[model samples]
Target: MIYFVYQILPHNCRSVRSILCSSLFLQKKGKKGAKAVEEEPVQVDAKDRIDFDSAKQKLQAVVDRFAKYANDAKLGKTSPKVFDNLMVQTDHGDQPYTSLAQTSIKGRNFIMTVYDPANIQRIINSVLGSGLNLNPVVDPSNKLTLKMPLPPITTELKNESVKELKNVYEKLRNGASLGKNHTLSSIRADARHKLTKNKKLDNLETEVWNEYEKLHKIYVSKLSEMIKAAETAIMK
Candidate 1:
């Protein structure tokens, strides 16, 4: 028995397909009483050849990150979730707020119960530095507990949040577009590499572009819808 392993990366989709076909060929040759044919042409299955799904999956990841930011980019209300994944500069390194402490909602305020009593000041400094205008107060006797008062929402603050939201949206949108183009270029290069050895694979490049365009439109539309929804939520 022979085995081949591939480490699937973002750009190696085509290479994996080729390897799978080769593996199938090997398996067929290994059967008892089977004869190995010289220079057998391995058929690349159409179902296996399409990589746009993977590309779209990667694109969705970018959009998802943006969506999280968008969700937190509002001035209307305060939730403990707003502090999720907030990177705090620590003596060791940068760490997420959730890693340092557990947060919960106490009426309109966000409460944090630190895991380490000594980390109280670190958590406090992080919340103060978050730019979310959360002024955290320590529970005098209970040093491990901290409470943050959610700022009162105002028209001016809402406008500022919306402005920041638009800025972040534009930046992420532009970056995603560039990333999409780069991925398309990489897929094109892979197609060309394979086509040079086999002209029968000429249609491979066309299929790649077609599939990419379809998925591209889907994700682009999704991002647009997200921004519009976010803006509406913030302004309302």
Candidate 2:
């Protein structure tokens, strides 16, 4: 006689009938008689489960990194370092703004001393298109010098800054979400591979998803609050 056995599968696992198989089968008689079939039960290891605490710790690390960046961005201050990595389009191609000119602060204004007089127009174009909202004009006496005045915070500038902040927030949020989803998928796949039972594996997945959602909300809300505070600081 043949006997079929089936094992419960977790969510995203194979169909119920997929694991159904004949545990006992008749053996063909050779010259004497038929041989008896033997059956053995499959056992699942209790230790194979999701490491949720480790996953949570990794997610927290990402949040901490972004938290510091958000904190540094809270205050609206003009500094020469702001232009450290500013890329400018040049005849040779894109290049760092600092490499093309020297930046110095005169009170609230930025004085740019270009290396070459011929590249004055190019530098001015870079600043105007830099999305920094600063207007650069050539000094009357010195053609090689550009004077950029830091305009007092206005409604228009504040709005621009907030828009930029939102862009940054979206990127960070999306990146974290992708990482979380990838990790969850890996967990689900491993459970399925081990043929874990439905109840236990499903429960573990639910808990992991809840934890990820909680962390996502916390970080997202924190970033939003920081952006709003930055907008307020710009208006002050």
Candidate 1 matches the true fold with a TM-score of: 0.55
lDDT tens string, model 1, 69-164?
788786344657778867777778988888889888778777889898767888888878877778788888678899877778787877877787
Error of 1 at 137 (Å): 2.6
Task: Tell me the TM-score of model 2.
Answer: 0.48
lDDT of 2 by residue, 1-236 (tens): 54456767887787464333343432233322423444678554434344546555554555565555555444333655566777878889988888889988888888889898777888888887877788889889888889987656566655665666666666565533345433333433443444444645465556654555565566557656766776676566
Candidate 2, superposed: residue stretches over 4 Å from native: 1-96, 102-106, 113-121, 125-146, 174-201
Candidate 2 least-lDDT 10 residues: 25-34
As for candidate 1, its clashing pairs are none
Model 1's lDDT to the true fold? 0.69
- TM-score on alpha carbons, each prediction: 0.55, 0.48
Best by TM-score: 1
